[model samples]
Target: MTEMATIMDCPPPGWEPLVEELARRVSPATVIHCHEPLAKRTTLRVGGPAEVYVEPASEADLAEVVKFVAERAVDLFVLGRGSNLLVRDGGIRGVVICLAHPSFSMVEITGERMRCGAGAKLKLVAVEAKRAGLSGVEFLEGIPGSVGGALRMNAGAMGAWSFAVVESVRIMDYAGRIHERPVAEVPVEYRACPLLKNHIALGAVFKCNATTREEVAQRMNSFSVKRWDSQPAAPSAGCSFKNPATIPAGRLVQELGLKGHRVGGAMVSLEHGNFIVNDGCATAKDVLDLMTLIQARAKTERGIELHPEVEIVGVD
Candidate 1:
């Protein structure tokens, strides 16, 4: 009897064929590559790679690719500006879709509302709002992410959150069905939007108030100054943990004497205890280890259960 072929001998479906097929089905979309480096894509700059990467040219193209991947039961992750994400060292398993195409970065202001694609930079949105003499979104000036990420995470800074200015949102589900829903229908909370967690945010309509351009700029500048003073300049995935209801995460870590603490190449930022910065050569494991240490210490010593605000993805 012939020996049975080993799993390696009969390898699973290769990503190349699927990527090719996706490109064919979704015209104008660019299939980047398999094993694409993820470190450079994330703010932390300390991840492995993506098995498949795609950049859709338009919302329609993104929907087509999403539907294709979903139909094949392949895992999909929609990448934003990667400001608050930590990908593991072993890398992601399936397709990683990035909506950073020019077609998805359009921002238009009409009356008191601004309609923007999800790929638009949060800073760009804030600038556009200021240019139009709009207020309310000035807090977004310091957020280092895109609209899609801001929507998904309800991203906030300087006491203002994304949902505060959000009027409506357009999302494409895993099945490639697009839905536009008013803010009332979307459940947004502290650093989370559960309803849209698995959905791809296509665009959003934001409501702003009429204000003097100077006033808007002043507010933006204030937030920028505050951020620059508090956050570290090193590569990091924003805040490492959420602020517990009782006290801010940074203060808590500082009180625990964890600031400047190091685990391998990852260190608790001396500038901001809530952040873990990668010192040029940190690995994902190093960061995870540091996080574990911080959590353990906080829970054991301070009786505080720290929760991570940064999204940790991929595998070990």
Candidate 2:
């Protein structure tokens, strides 16, 4: 994680009251700042700032903060590691809760099942599962997001998805009530978990098959090599578009001659047509414009509608 600079003492205008009230209600859990720049929080390293940034110490504290924000009718966004997200220049309006606290990042294994916190990185979860001699999540080793983000998006790689191994998920509602639902109960589809769109995932339980640790590690290493070979080395939010039913998004973009295309500091990655990389000074608008160009060209030339896989949030 990149170190954040010193936080400003003064809150952003019009958010002073909200910040003060939040500080009182959500004590112990640090309320970092108002108008905190979001670039460092995301993998792409682009984006403006968050209205009110918060880091809850524990699940209970997170719940309290959520309930407080909900009752006051403030818009809330639960940010994970920001691997597959793009926050616009105008920034997020209300509270931005980040589940980076240690309490929300615990990982445990028991009897062929592993439980991981929402804040736990996908790579860490994969390593933990391998340590326990579990298989089936080797694909997660290459994904660049947190477990919660992965679950929310039904994140997949190398023919494996989050829901395929999910046994159950612990989620917290807008009112701060927690519930456990089986995988069957959650409406998980390709690249989406609609049930978790509004609620926040706390942790997930995955059922894995018993396997040799060496075998799991080998599979994981294979996946890592494949990802490194295909994906860009520059900062990016992974694939910009989801693969349509008929064709892979990357292949389609390549066919459309969109590879190496640039809009401002954002460019279509030469290594992978599906990725839009930040060449140090890219902004959210640049990425969005590049996406629009790709979508337009694909639709006009190939009659294929390209849909973004990366979540676009905040005002523009």
Candidate 3:
């Protein structure tokens, strides 16, 4: 089949055309995998295929791809490590852009300030911070997502959150224009951020403080131990629900005697009441059903509404 025909035939509006246009404008080496498996890319090991999944070789290449999609009004989803996401079984509609390649993962440390790309893993960031004698990011060692994902979700643990250490963030709008803004510009609260709908985070600079390497490492280890005792790191998203300010969500679930609640193949982790696990042979419907049940039970029984921590994507 001709390349253009393969990319264009029966694809979503503007999706195939944009792909073909990108193939012409960008170098062949810069674009990888016109179509890729979503299940393999996500930590959950669930989800259907994506029509076009591009791994841009460099920042310029990534920008170009974003611009093309923006101009054409094509649907696009930016993914970074895919740790706290639940992709539906029917698959995504348009393009899924992944920024996990080394070109998007460069890191720099200078005294109390650290600059890292959006694709850098939070765990790796913690380790690097320790080597650089930085302390604020030590709590990030237990986070399982990328820097971009962390910023998007305002991921927090051990009394520290990504936004708390963030001095400024580099962002790229759909038009490919890059801009930097201080943390105050982005409203953050309870694992939520008011990031622009069309802007994707490129990287961030964090104003951390100097500390002894031994001290930072020690804190990271202690935080890890604490997390292991509280969360089910076996195979699940870090937390399933946002803790209400008045009380912890896990504690509430436990109080309701719903620690091991199950719906189909999906079950709330016995280890942590807030986490829902696939157990084995779980379907997307099973997960959705279980979440619905939990939310209902929490409201009807406890007079509290539990908010989901994980982002649900794709069609049912």
- Top model by lDDT, which number? 2
Between 2 and 3, whose TM-score is larger?
2
- lDDT agreement with native, every candidate: 0.88, 0.89, 0.79
Q: For model 3, where is the 10-residue window of minimal lDDT?
A: 1-10
Candidate 3 lDDT, tens digit per residue, 1-316? 3232123234444555566777665555565455476766766666676777777767777888888777776679988888898788887777778888787797799879989999999888988999988989988898888998888888888788889999999998887789999988888877866684468888999899997999998998999899888777555665778888788888888888888888777778888888887776677677778888888988998788888888888876
Q: Go through the candidates in order and give the clash count of each.
A: 0, 0, 0
Model 3 / residue 176 / CA error / Å:
0.6
lDDT of 1 at 5: 13
Q: Please list the residue runs of candidate 3 whose C-alpha ends up more than 4 Å from where it truly belongs after superposition.
A: 1-18
lDDT of 3 at 33: 57
TM-score of model 1 (CA atoms): 0.94
Error of 3 at 219 (Å): 0.7
Worst 10 residues of 1 by lDDT: 3-12
Of the candidates shown, which would achieve the greatest TM-score relative to the real structure?
2
Model 1 lDDT per residue over 1-316, tens place: 3321111111125755566566567654344566778999999999888887778877777888888887899999989999999999988888888999888898999999999999999999999999999999998987889999999999987778999989999999888889999999998878999987788999899999999999999988988899999889999999999999999999999999999999999999999999999999999999999999999999999899999999999989
Candidate 1 Cα deviation (angstroms), residue 76: 0.7
Candidate 2 clash pair list: none
Give per-residue lDDT, candidate 3, residue 307: 87
